[model samples]
Every structure is written in C-alpha cells, then in structure tokens.
Target: MTTWDEHAAQLADTVTHPRSRWRDAIRATPRHLLVPRWWHNDLTGTLLLDGPTDPHRWMRAAYSDTTLVTRLGSLHADLAHPDDRPPWWPSSSSTLPSLIVRMFRHARPETGQNILDVGTGSGYGTALLCHRFGDQHITSVDIDPYLTATARERLADIGHKPLIAATDATGPLPDTYDRIIATVSVPRIPAPWLAALRPGGRLVTTITGTSLIIGADKTPDGGALGRVERDWAGFMGTRHGPDYPPRLMHQFPHARDQDGDDITTGRYPVLDIAEAWEVNTQLTLAVPGIETHFETDGDDRTAYLLHADGSWARAHGHWTDAPTVHQSGPRRLWDVLERIRHKLNIEGSLGLYGYRVHIEPNGRCHISQGGWTAVIE
Candidate 1:
C-alpha cells in the first residue's frame, strides 16, 4: 500500500490556494488516522462510510478534502464495531478542507499568537492550527466532553498538546486570546467571545441566519469592533448539549399539516441556496426569520419561503395557468425574493457581500451593506 500520502497530495493540489500554509497542513496530516470510522446519512438513519467491500474508495474518501461526520446526538459513529451499522443525524464533523482554509484566511492569525478554536470537531483543524503555530499557542473548546476528549487524544497522538475545554463556547473562555475563530455559526457574536480578545485582537465568526463572515477587532473597553460580510463562510449552529433542538416543524403547529396551501407545485428544484449567495444574503437581510425550501416533482416544481410572521409563499411553475402562486398572512414572500434577486441582477451584486460587521459592549451587533443597515440582537 502506498498509504494515503500519494492521494492526499493529489487532493491538496486541487485546493484553490495550493501554496497556502493551511494546504500544507491538509497534505501533511493523515486525515484517515484522525477519523478512522465515520458516518453517512441514509433515508432512515446514518451508516458508516466504509467497510471491507472496497478498500481503495474508502482510502480515497478518507483522505480527500471531503467532510465526514463522526458524532450525532450522543452517539459516536466512529465507535460502531465493524458489525454494527447505526443511523444518526450529523452533530459534529471534520469540516471540508476548503472551508477550513477559508476560515484561516479570514482569521489572519499572526505568527505565534494565541488562538481559541470553537467546536473542535474532529481535531483536524486543531492539528493544522498547532502545526502552523506551536502546541502552547492553541486552545480548543467544545460543549461535549466526549468531543473534547477525543480531540485532545488525537492531538496527543499527533505529538501536540493544546488546552481543551469541555464547555459551551457561547460563554466566557478561561483565557483571553489574540485570535478567536469559531467553526460553528452563531446567532450573534457572543459577548464573551468579544471580551476574551486582547486589545486589537480578532474574532472570526459566521452569523447563523445568514452565513455572513464577520471579522472584528478588540477595543480597550472590554467591548470589541469589527465588520461582517467580507467573506463567505457557514457552519451548523453552535449546539449546547448532546442533542440539538428539534426542527421548527416540531415547535410550530402550522409548520406541518397546515391548511394554507398543500397543493403547491414548485418552480425550482431544492436549489442549493449556497449557489445563490447574492439572493440568499439579500433576502436574509430583508426577512430575518424566513427559511426557504424548494422541491421538484418532475415537471411540477415548487418553491416555499416561510417566515415567523405567519407569512408564506408557494409558487408552482410549469402550470397551464402560468405557475399558480398562493400567499397568505402579513408579508409576501415571493415578492420579497423577486425584489432581492432583481436588485442583485440590476446592480450586478448584492451589497450584503460588501457589508461590515460591527460589535459593541452591550452585545449590540449591526450590519451595513449598500447604504442599507440593520441591527441584530
């Protein structure tokens, strides 16, 4: 066996910034060793991603830049014996290599500076961080004790030791940091995160509702200053415990089996919203709590954007009646979406990408794009 080295190098070459220091970490680190066993989703549940059936594909996938989830709910997918196949929802993972590199680019950590890494998922990124800086300069935290323990052991196996804290990262950290990079999306840049930075320190984060990249600098008054939307990054929300909250369908009575409009045909396939960053971020700004879902039943395509305001829009394209649309409640979802897309198409860009993220001591947050500004609580 040539080991994963040969293929790892091949994968490294495919990255956007081939010469970046972070790419070198991806190349040097044997990812399979960090995640020997992992999970994949099935219609009913999650299953291990590998088996003895095909060793070569397993080797390739394990070392490639692709992501693999290792934990879900309280279950450790990697702990499943060879004979066991368990189903699970992804709760933690080793993020894809490209995303990690983007985060490092946004973090812009100085040489020898102390860093706090939130959500130390498979410790892959942590290892890369330690490799870039020294062992004493890294501190990783996760809410799950098992995750923290697993990452700590993986770090030791790689012959590096960084402090690991098994606590929620939304609150205060034990030590102040020069740079803080969170791997999970947050509702807002938590006050503790801003407070933990030394003066002029940087906090790199992504807003959960919008996936906007925010980089802030620490000020003297325990408050911090920074801007959002300079980069594009996203992660699952910061989970507090073994299980994340149930989906909104479980909370809202109308979310499931609603009487509004059940016979809607959609105009788009479940569009990968990431593909439409312009429209996505634009509408995310105009409508804070709205979530869009799309589906296609062959020719009958449907698009649905739902909001907490009891407003919903359903458009069925390809219909003989010119794509029937049904909307109910206070606001019009389709109108807002079309307006956002039209603005982007006319301007050739959505200003959200050009916005800045600012933070305050009272935990106030604001975003400004294209002369438009809004506050985030």
Candidate 2:
C-alpha cells in the first residue's frame, strides 16, 4: 500500500523545485480530505468517484497534479447520488497543485503579509497557504455558500482554520490584503479589487475567455500596471450564481449546415478555435463574446462560431484542406479569423505575451505592445 505521505512527497517532487518553499507546504497538506468525492470524465461519459469506497484510486487521484471537478451545473458531487449524471460543463473544481503554486509564485507573497484567496473551491489551496504562511494571514472567499461552508469544515478537520466567507469576489471584498490571487477568471478587473488592494499591493489573475495570466502591481493612483506572463493558464470564469448562463448552443445547430448570406472557400484549413489558445486569444481580443463549437465525423470536420448580436460563421471540410465558409449577420467572423491568421503568418508570432497592461481604477484595461493596442472595457 502506498501511504499518502509518500504520494504527497512524490507529487511535491514532480511539481515543485527541490529547494522551493512550497514543497514543504505541499508535502504537509492532505489533499484527499478536502476532495472526498469528485466527478471524473471518461470516454463513455462523466462518472462519479467516491473516495472512501476505493481508497487506492482515491489516494492516486487526490495526490496527483490534476484538476478534479467537484461541481457540475448547480449539482455538487457531495449532494449527488451515485447514479445521477449532472450537466457536462464543470461549475467548480479543485485546481491542479502545480497551477496553484505557479500563481502563488507570480504573486510572490512574503511572510507577515495578508493574502486573499479567491474562488475557494476545495480549500486545498487555502490549506497550502495556511501551511506556508500563518492562518491569520489567509482569507478565502467564494460566492457559493455551500462551498465555503463545506470548505471551512474540511479545513478544520485538517487542523487549519482560515477566514472562509461566502462573498462575490467581483464585488466588494471582505477586507484589505497585500496580495490577491484569483483561481477564477474574470472578463475584466473589477473596480472593487483595486479599492480593496492595499498600496503597493499585487494582484494575479487570468482574463476570461483567454489563457493569458496577468501579474500587475498597484500604482499610485489606485490602478495597476503590468504585462502578460509568458506562461499561459486557463480557469473557469467567475459566476455570481450556482452555474453559468446557457451557452449559445441553440445557434450551433442552425449554423452547422445552413447557407449563409455569404459563402466562400477559406484561405486556410479548418481550425478548432477553442483548442488553439493563441489564435483563440487573439480572436477574443479582436471580436469579444464569440462562442465556438467544433465537431468531426470521419475525416470531415466542421467548426461554428456564434455571437449574441446575430452573427455566425460555419466552416466545414476535410482535415488539412481549405474549408468552405458560410457567414451571416453584421460581422464576418470567418474573415476576421483569416485576417488574424494572415497576421500570424506574416509576423511568425502573435506577440500576445509580454504585452504591457494598464488598468484603470474602473477596471478598464489598455493593453499594448509596440504600436498595437486594445481596450477591455
């Protein structure tokens, strides 16, 4: 039998440096207690795993550096029956240990400084923080009452107690902190975050709909200035309620095969926009609020792009071949994608990384690199 301590040590060795300060914290924390039950997706469908029933598999999963989804739609795995199948989209998860450590390293918190942990999902990250710094310097918050309450109990069982609260991180926070790190992604930096950050404080988070991780330091005028990190990370977007709103899936069916106002042979092969992180990021910056879906049957592939403003585009063809694109509404979504691809081909890179970011107090972001600039309002 592999003891959990041995597993923890192995996990620590794999994810962190031998001399890293976080190694000890990772070794000391027991991850299984925080996530006793979670949902696992396999080829057939989503499956629920009950830890106590299978201790060996539980230890392997809990200690491994992989995210475990704990909630689907509004249904929590804890409250669900063994036979129930919740929605496919994950609402909350215990983020992988390495990513948590990566974000912490970006913040670079020193001892005796207060830290706010946003999106208290499994409380595993809070436990690590308590072990690294004292519990007195840690505070974790989430919008879901059940998540906070359950996390508080689990944390207490592990002999750690940090201030755990049910509050919306996008709105007013509970108190001031020297560093704020959010596991959930936000479309824009909320104004309340700037006000809650102490002078000379730092904030580390990811922008929604992109894999860009931002590390910003507070400015004198209650704003922030920083740049996009070279490393990329993706997180679930912040939600005010139990689950995110319905996706634009209704538009997908129509766009799948219907003729559009304009049709043409695409200059490039069909691309899965969701999987191409850099291309997806650039497209989000160029045309915000677009939803994408991709499907494949045999060697033929189809990709659809839909927006709330009655705009849509569909491209379909064999893999590696130029697709036939159909587009409608005010914007030509496929043309926009081609223009972006054209730039990528011409420049050899998108230059999204290392872009300078200037955030106003109201959370409007002015991002630029060289002569190019874009605003996130």
Candidate 3:
C-alpha cells in the first residue's frame, strides 16, 4: 500500500512544476489530517466518509486535486450521522490544491509580506501558506466558529500555529496585510478588505456568481486597479451567518412545468446555463441575483431560471434541439439568456477575460473592456 507521503509527492508533481515554489509546501503538508472526513456527493445524495474508517479512500480523496465538501448547510460532515442527508447546497469546502496555487501565484506574495487567507474552510490552504511562509506572517479567517476552532486545532497538531479567527470576511478584518487571498467568492470586493490592505499590497479573489478570478494592486487613491485573469475558477459565496439564505427553491415548482405569461420557441438548443460558465457569467453580469437549475431525464432536458423578484423562465426540449421557452413576471428571463447566447455565437467569446477592473475605496467595482462596461455595487 502507498503511503500518504508518496501520494503528496505525486500530487505535487501533478499540480506544480519541478521549480515551482509551492512544490515543497504541497509535499510537506498532510492534507489527510486537515480533512479527516468530508461529504461525497453522488447521484443518490451526499454521503459522509470518515478518514479513519477507510484510510485508503480517505488518502486518495485528500491527496487528489479536487475540492472536498466539508460542510453542507449548517451540518459539518464530522457531526453528521451515516444516514444524515442535508438538502442544502455545499456551504464550505477545502478548495482544490491547484486553484489555491493559482490564486497564490496571482497574489505574488513575498517572503516578508503579511498574508491573510480568507475562508479557511478545511485549513488546507492555510497549512500550505504556513509551510511556504512562516506561520507568524499568516492569518486565516472564516465565519464559522466551529471551522476556525477545528482548523486551528488541526493546524496546531501539525506544528503550525497561525492565527485562525472566526469572523465574517465581508465585514471588518482583524488586521491589515500586504496580501489577501480569498478562497470564498464575494458579491464584490468588501470595503473593509480595501481598507485593510497595506500600501503596495495586492489582493486575489473570485467574484460571486461568476468564474472570474481578479487580481488587483492597491492604488494611491485608496482604491485598486487590475484585470480579470484569463484563468477561470469558482468558489462558494461568502455567507454572513451559519449558512446561506434558503435557496430560491420556492420558485422552482411554479417554474418547472407550468405555463408562463409569455411563451416562445428558443432560437438555440437548450443549454445548461450553470454548466456554461462564460455564458452564465455574462448573464450574471447582465442581471444579478438570478438563480439557475437544470435537469435531464433521458434525452429530454429542462432548464429553469428564477429570480427573487418573482420572475422565472423554463426551457424544455430534446437534446441538441430548439427548446420551448416559457417566461413570465416583470422581465422575460429566456429572452435575456437568448441574447447572451446570440452574443457568444456572433462574437465567439464573452470577452470577460482581461477586462480592466477599477475598484473604488467603498468596494464598488467598475469593469470595462473596449465598448463594454459594468459595475458591481
């Protein structure tokens, strides 16, 4: 049987180059310790896997370059029973190792710089940072007290004593830092995060509802300017409390099969909006706060778009065929999706990558690329 050290070495080789600065850190840290148990989602439901009970499977999962869901809703996998199943979406996860390396590369932290690691879900990222940089220069924060406490203990057990605090990342941070890298997504850059940046500091994070990774340097005007990275990544949105607000599930049934106020045949084949990251990003930028759901029964596919404002749209059809769309409420949801698809088909891309980003001191972001511009408030 292969040991965890061997697995870590293999993972290091897979995710980083031989000369990569992160290679040593990845190989040194024991991920299995940080994530002793996690939830594995299958076609049936989310299942809990305890590391001690199945060491081989646990080692395989922990060392793999994959995100491990550690918590669903308010229930941590450690506390869940064998048969326990939470209906909510994943609220916390140990982000994939490669993406963590990518975000750190974007931040470009140096030896003497103080770093803040936001959303310390499993403390795996924090452990890597502690290994690469000294523990004294690292501070990690998460909203859940249980997560922080457990992570702090687990990290200490591994001979790392970084400051791990339980605090809302969207609000005031504990202290200022030269580099801030968030594993969790935010609706926009938090004003406190902007205020907490030291002079000549930089930040790397992803926008909520999109797979956009942005890196920005502190500006003399107390703001920051940067651009959307070419690489795409997604993270769970930051929550202020134990769990996120209930999903927009209440609107699903009505939008699932019922006739809508407006009906039409879609100009294109039915597509899973959530799976089409770029198209989904465009739609999110065009209309914020929209929720999407997709399902397929055999060859018949159905997609639904719902909003908190009581607007909904459903598209149903056979695979690769034009869908019959039903839309209702104040705005035609299907029309918006169609327009975005049309733009992608004509332009060949959404052009979100490399877009210039200007963030105000108050955290409002102005993103522009050529003739296109949008603001996130």
Q: Report the C-alpha lDDT of model 2 over 100-158, residue by residue, as the tens digit.
A: 99999999899999999999999999999999999999999999999999999999998
Select the stronger candidate by lDDT from 1 and 3: 3
TM-score of 2: 0.98
Q: Rate the local accuracy (lDDT) of all candidates.
A: 0.74, 0.92, 0.92
**Candidate 1 on 131-176: residue-level lDDT in tens?**
8888899999999888889888877987879998899999879899
How many steric overlaps does candidate 1 have?
Answer: 11
Count of steric clashes across candidates, in order: 11, 0, 0
Better of 1 and 2 by TM-score: 2
RMSD to the true structure for each prediction, in A, is 3.5, 1.1, 1.1
Compose the digit string of candidate 3's lDDT tens values, residues 1-377: 99889999999999999999999999999999999989998888778889999999999999999999999888999899999988748999898999999999999999978999999999999999999899999999999999999999999999999999999998999999999999999988999999999999999999888999999999999899999998999889999988888778564677877899999899998888888999988888888998898889999999988888888999899998988999988889889999999989999988879999999999999999888899987
CA shift of 265, model 2, Å = 1.4
| TM-score of every model versus the real structure | 0.85, 0.98, 0.98
